[model samples]
Target: MRDDAPHTSNVPYLPRRSVHLDFHTSPLITPIAQQFDPQEFADRFARLGVDSVTLFAKCHHGQLYYDTDRAERHPGLGGVDLLRSQIDALRPLGIRTPIYISVLFDEHAATTHPEWVCVDEEGGPVRVDSHGVPGWHVLDMTSGYRSYLAEQVTDVLGHFPDADGFFYDICFDQLSSSATARAAAIEAGFDPDSPAGRLDAAAAVSHDYMGRLRDMVAGDGHDGVPRSVFFNSRPRLRLADELGFSTHDEIEALPTGGWGYAYAPSVARSVIPIQPRAIGMTGRFFGSWGDSASIHPAAALQYESLQMVSLGLGICIGDSLPPAGRSHEAVTARLADTFARVQAVQECATGAQRVAEVAVMRAPITGGEGVIHADAPGAGELAALRLLTSRGIDFDFIGPGDDLAGYRAVIVLSGVGIDDGVVRSLTLHVESGGALVLSGLPDDVASLQPLTGLSSADVDGFAREFVRPNAAATGLPDFDFVLPGAVRRVRAEGDVHTLATVTEPYFDRTPDRFSGHEYTPAGAATAYPAIVARERVATAAFGLFEAYGATGVPEIGDLAAATLEAVFPRPALRIDGAAHLEGTLGRRSGSSIVHLLSYLPSRRSSADIETVVDPVPALDVAVRVRLDDRSPRAVRTLEGVELPFSVEDGYVHFTVSFDDGHCLVVVEEE
Candidate 1:
């Protein structure tokens, strides 16, 4: 498939503005949904511009919200049938209602049937945390819980035939040493006794059940339309392998909930190339789920929502419905305002594809664990997100499965393992005149020596070093710049140009030999090259990406950007603006949209929470878009205000400004 082509599937239409309502009611709570007024509830969502709502069918508490004879309903619900009522209320108002089901963490099941609990290799039951604390227990899917889950799902399907889709939560593999798991592993041709074998077997079992559940959902449709199926909590790194079990991708990244703000954009960029129709899920609370009364700032919501839509992704704001089923007034108000802003730019963002000329290989996960969180933003990935986006360089996070032919440049950050397939693809890319940039050497550096033109690449025995750009290097100071990270020593063979040299520190910081408070200062310049280039391939001795992520160093970004520009001079998009501004270019058949967002988040309190409190000031931004031979018929904002532009050397140049933290400009073809 072409990189820009839409990922067409039989899934239901994805709503731009949606809500994931959590209703994990405890059995002790009485009179659930007692205050729920169907018309009022549906009206509020419609007024907020919400087109879809995911209501809970079964929650982690193992309480069914709908009327079912095969399972236990929340004791507080009485005869309310919360899920049915929610669907009936919203469906008539032209709102899509998707059902949510908890797959692994079921409190009631774990407490009632001890045999159904998942067991670790150490013979300990798997759970969220200590048993003394209040947390959900994981149930073994290979055990009897599988039948119970399937029966409950079938019941939901039969009852809510009009539902638009299904969202399965906690759909990750678990390492288990149970009898059923061992037997299933053996049947699947895997040895259960080996740790690697057990991990593989667990993933196989999870994938099998997910596929079966997806088929079941697909088989039962609403009229002639197919229902969307998404297995939440699956790792983004393995999306290529698990895409078969999902109809649409929904990234559940609550920034305040342990996932930093960079996680969503990194994951979204990676996902949209594979599945254009995807949702970026964030939460309305200040922290994570279960924070009922707490509300995030309106500015924060606007920043997140605008950024998501700018990337051509649907927006889903996560929320927890209180026991009385009343909406949080303050939170809903902020959401209503944010949704209005999103609706305003829907015209420019609706069908446009992300225009990227650079592909950065995402860093591999630590430990190579089978059951990993969906959003694993490594230091390199986070730096890539910061550097690329801030520089207004449109790019995408790629994996081994992605085709490198579509991009003009491919960047392999440090810490990303290079497998045979990746090596082959990158070699082909470089041979075809595409730019190839690499950071510090990975474990498989020997395999790429010929391509990199490096006679030797080894780690220098220095904890910290400095980079000194040569006189020929542009946009870099002549003085040495501190690189507070591990440095690698490299020697280029024949026909290679040295961009920068290494400046070694006096000594490694020891308890007794430390020079300063932190580490030693730079001592002397070494002949070993810090940055080198052969043809279109550029190599860095240290991980500029990693250093930038670990420490907010402006010099690192500048050097990285300069190196990239040296090799990949003509990018798809470039914006000259403040570092606070992030830009993305989106293109359709005849027009292109340029999205500009500016927001600075800071630590608000003593806690680690970061929030945006001030509005962005107005500033003009100069932009250059590579349109090749095409001429612009019109250049205007989404509001139709025309702007003057000129095309020079294959780039269409224009300037735009905004004061409300987000701006979108449209360029039409003649």
Candidate 2:
């Protein structure tokens, strides 16, 4: 195990370079693993710099790859223990093999035992594919499928006692209306008829199942070797509640595979704090899993892998094995190049710790109604990340329960529910000299009076309004710009500074009152304030974060950046470059490593394929790092090239040039 490898109590260390091989062979397919030469398989993976490979024990097609009597084996395997053979081959080569098992979406279990199928609210079987489509069906985890899965797991454990670990897939909320689930919900004192109650019941089942599975794997038979455990398909945002179930996080965000370029960074930032020993999973396919023919461009793979390592996390490239069990030449070759790039900067990224200056609340603090819950990142959370990233501002996502003392500013997005606890936290943060930025109107304005220094008034009673930035509003146009969302009117009390004011239109665009072809022009400037700031706290009456996400208006992001600046003027780290050049700062040992990524994805075809063909043009980058009073011993690239530098105002200022997709700069402090 390397020093840079991610580790947990159960799993002491995980390989930095791993591969997730998906082998979901249908029962009808012929000669599964028949052509699989153990040596060839091992040689290919070892050649590609893979230290760990997740092999399949069972797949969504409901067929086991290994020789098993308790479950239906893949007919194509012809009584071959494919799983065991692969492990036998890889283990001797010093490669760890984590066996994968499908949990909920099992076609065999659902087809043969229809009684175990998950029932949806409409009394129909819950499924991933629509009617007449050929795909796996969802099974009720609280039904007989629970015992069935447990039995299969026991069988696997009994056979391969020395297996490296287990990777559980499709472990998420399988909300059900089945009799068993309904009865369990009732026994747990929840109204199964309600959507919220049903969701809660489902979450409880998932949590319990996860605990049982974890205990079973950790139970006696490991031969003293610690085994890793992970559950895929669970929402990353909600992992805070279920951290006990897994040893590490395998974030599966295939950028070109529908999880866009922004998804990986946003998810990694949120999940890394809780589970630092994590790996970012991206597929080799340009599209997604099972798209074997259309491979990812070499540039895309390099960008994805470098981005993951840059964040102080390991990288895993996903690939699928053909039924004949031979590795694809093209995929193998491309991966070799990508892995080499990762190895180039492996030393610099080894022990780096990301430095975040601001904490963006994932959900608003609620009084008791509970904060927002979603299977994906909330609009405000994702949008806020994009805004900050574009401006070269570093941040992390935090829940209400997370500590705020380490952060310089806290951003509360729109559409969040507020409670007294939230109000107290914000108030304390502001009073302690920390900054607070509220995106939109909360349910109750009076609750935040201490922070906002304003009282609840009335709505602006207009469909839309224009914002005119005063001199106090820095970096904004003095002229009016369209503010495109609902604005909550508030009366400024005490000593509050108005950064911008609202200008209402002459009249509503009614049938009788016609203006230009579109919205009415700005007519009168009102006393209402669009932005207000009071002693380390600022409020944007409109849902700027949410609006910016929904509509990528340039003015909206500009306003957000300026508002953040007004509250927290001195960020810990600042970078001056093209907006597309994403910067990530981290500390390791006696130095800090700054990762600059400069690859821009392009949609080349009508099918919406995001590909990166060429490296970015030569970019001149300037970085300002706050070292306080300590002087910099040296500033150099990871390749050991010393660069010219200067010090001023307790900060080290340096400049470097990089045209490559990724660049690593190390700053040594004395």
Candidate 3:
């Protein structure tokens, strides 16, 4: 994280480090793991703008990807030094590679020397039937297994200092049956026949055992890279550090109806004022909501998600590797490509000149739309914010009014619970000539009542997701209107410009922890409308709008693409449809690389579908850039080279294309 650039007020914009791949992922595509092809991989990422990767899976395991004396070949598996070749190839691509070590999952060593494994609840060793393996013993970690683990971790790290750091996975099961059973074993005096007492020893062994190993990792002489633990629930921050860990990651991979990658930037960022270390969000079990869809790698949501993390929101994107230790080559390629873009962003951000002269925007509610919806208890706002950010729209920040004059627009989220003062400030933003938009008011009024022109009153229902392509909109027929009276006519553009409208209102419960109110059954919806506009460049970005993310395509109060750009007028980037893929920004040679990734064989799985048995068959990408801001530029495609630009509304547009499952394109000023 070192840089030669002098710090500035904008230094907060500096990029932070990120490693998307985690060790515990379940790869449906059979992750591409072969005779490590470093050069080819490096070249792939070089195009993407990434240069660092945290080798989480087989990188640090005692078992080798291929046969090697340095480690044991996992039982019934061939070996491959995927890490070594990847790292070696990456060096030339100017990428940093790191490995994750699960000192806990050394099946070979742990099972062979059960003494080194963790004990059960009572103080005796934990015993698992190994799923179907009837006699395989669960290694006991509590009973003096420190040396064994340290050696394993150190050895793995020692092999690759060039790696960014270590991503520790599933080592501490603070809330697993294993811990419960171990506790019982301890009370039973390690008595196997003690009925319920069968786990006390195992629990104590696990708890104390992990603690000791943690100390050794910190105190041990041979220091590997800084370590980060996965979804560690051991509450105290100091405790995590004492155990040789620097990062306590957010939860990753839990079923949220299948939203791929289990982290929400909006929720995470909203909590930053309270806890800074809650920087990362990790979700392993992803469940798709009937409404939400996969991310488009070329879209702003991707950028916003990363930016939210960059702006003090650490991110943890996790996936499970195949049991066979293989990763889908296509998936890996997409990862590498996006990693490059993210790396570039981070590099540019961290090493930039900071100048503290800009304005910020608050999420806006135009016309009849008012305060935004309250956050659901478990669903954080970080993801929502990221969705906005990924669109490249700069949002209004929360701070002193001194910065207000610096901003051109002030959006108001008119929800049932908005404090009165905000309503007053919003009244002023509109009166001052700023553009606005709204969602989920009433259809009774033919025109927008307040907020900004970002909305319209004709009240067509919400529009279909652009990714799916819908020319018509289907929104809430009508709803109760909650006008605070503080808002009035912000502007009258005539037919020349119509009031814009966001999609339908969404309902959700606030995170059980952050709110003071009792949970209510009615639930809260994004009652507010969205607004958008361009602000001063250095001081702030143009385009600000409130959005109730896709609870379902074209919701009653959700934001729409056409309306979004209408109110904002200016945007960092624009897209045509909803995406079948996800993307991110990266760097390979310390430059910006924008990644657009989609799993190959993209057979549509409605967010409701669970397991990913196959990937999308075709996930190509095509972005039109403003290269030189004038002349037309050509991007290559399977169809053939095509012009990606045309003079439209006084701006030059160029296309950068990626196609069929996975693709990427980098844009550097010519």
Lowest-sum lDDT 10-residue window in model 3:
536-545
Alpha-carbon lDDT of model 2: 0.80
TM-score of each: 0.92, 0.92, 0.42
Residue 221 in model 3: lDDT = 14
Decreasing TM-score order of the candidates: 2, 1, 3
Q: What is candidate 2's CA lDDT for residue 413?
A: 80
Where does candidate 1 have its weakest 10-residue lDDT segment? 1-10
Query: What is the per-residue lDDT of model 1 for residues 1-670, given as tens digits with 9 covering 90 to 100?
Result: 0122343344466767888999888888898788998988988887887878989999998989888776577878877878888888887776778899999988888988989998887898887753238477889989999998898888888898766789999988787888998899999999999987987898898898898788777753444457878898887766776777887898777777667677788888888777776888888888777766788778888888888988888788988898998887777788889888888887556678877878998665433443324456677777778888876777788865578878889888886777787788889999898998897766555778878777554555588788888766756678777876656777778888788888888888888788988779889888888878888998887787777777777777777777787788888789888887899888988988889898887787987767777658648789988899899988898778999999899888998888888888888986
Q: Write the per-residue lDDT of candidate 3 for residues 384-424, one digit (tens) a residue.
A: 34344434343433322223443444332223123334434
Error of 1 at 627 (Å): 2.6
Residue-level error in angstroms, candidate 1, position 15: 2.5
Q: Clashes per prediction?
A: 1, 1, 197
Q: Looking at candidate 2, what is the lDDT of residue 346?
A: 80
* Candidates arranged by lDDT, highest first: 1, 2, 3
